[model samples]
Target: MGSKQSVLQENGYTVMSEQHNTIMLKNKDGDQFIIKKLKADQNEASDFLQKLNHPHIVHHKEIIKDGDCLYLVMELCEGGDVSQKIKQTATFSEILDWTVKICMALKHLHDQQILHKNLQPKSLFFTACGTIRLGEFGVIHEWSSGAQITNPEALSYIAPEILKGEPYDEKS
Candidate 1:
């Protein structure tokens, strides 16, 4: 479980796999989690997770820091992302169910004044029990009033007004 520079071993999580800067781990109780080492000092995602409590949102267990790496311990979605699930054969009811779940999650986020700037197929994950959960809050923004923010990294999912560089509210 010891990588060249990872401290997951000290935290009681066994390394399952490593990809680039992220590692998948599982604890002794058989609970799996994903650990992502951030390259910068950012707490937006952690803050959002801590403030949110919904069934359709991915859960954040804890955050660990070892030297320069910031490891985010999150619930492991065994069913993977929705994009992969959509590519497979599914019933109409199943599709509708997933859509409703996503809408519920979005409504919750919006009610909290949190905008998921990066809304895409990859950001939608499914838990082991097949519950849809919205994830990937790296580009989430907290909005109030008519404030506008820019997200060049989320070009694919960015709204039209945002792409046009227009100052828009949370609806955009």
Candidate 2:
């Protein structure tokens, strides 16, 4: 968390932007990486990163720990997410375009048997060329039928069955 100074890299080091609990690295190849610290027993996070790989999802480049803080080096979405972009543009078409792309990404995940339980505007990244991509599937999962209940974050996108305290079909 110092003024853009040279930081550690593979075999060498590079200068990066330092945030509160995260660091943004500008790799020698001109690629930007957002590294953040991880809490203890983050096996779920580690598993999600290893299991899921999609074009719409942000890439997990590396995982490092400088001292006690664990760093998850991920591809930095330069233009920010859909919500941030929409805040600047009040047009319906812009919102539609972003939603379509985001929905497509969601459908893709569903096809892979993965549910992105947290599907908020902030989690949908937007590009300059008007594209919406999903990010942060750390809490994503492929649950089996007739499973026990848990995870309150998923309640927002819950289906009718779940609302009625019935077994939830994640694919639905």
Instruction: Give TM-scores for every candidate, taking all chains together and pairing residue i with residue i.
Output: 0.84, 0.67
Whole-model lDDT values for every prediction: 0.78, 0.62
Question: Can you list the residue pairs that collide in candidate 2?
Answer: none
lDDT of 1 by residue, 56-154 (tens): 998888887665666888898889897899999978999899999989998999898888877888889999889999998776667742223444555
Worst 10 residues of 2 by lDDT: 2-11
Q: When superposed on Cα atoms, how far off is each prediction in RMSD?
A: 3.5, 5.1
Off by over 4 Å in 1: 1-6, 144-154
Candidate 1: residue 30 lDDT (0-100): 87
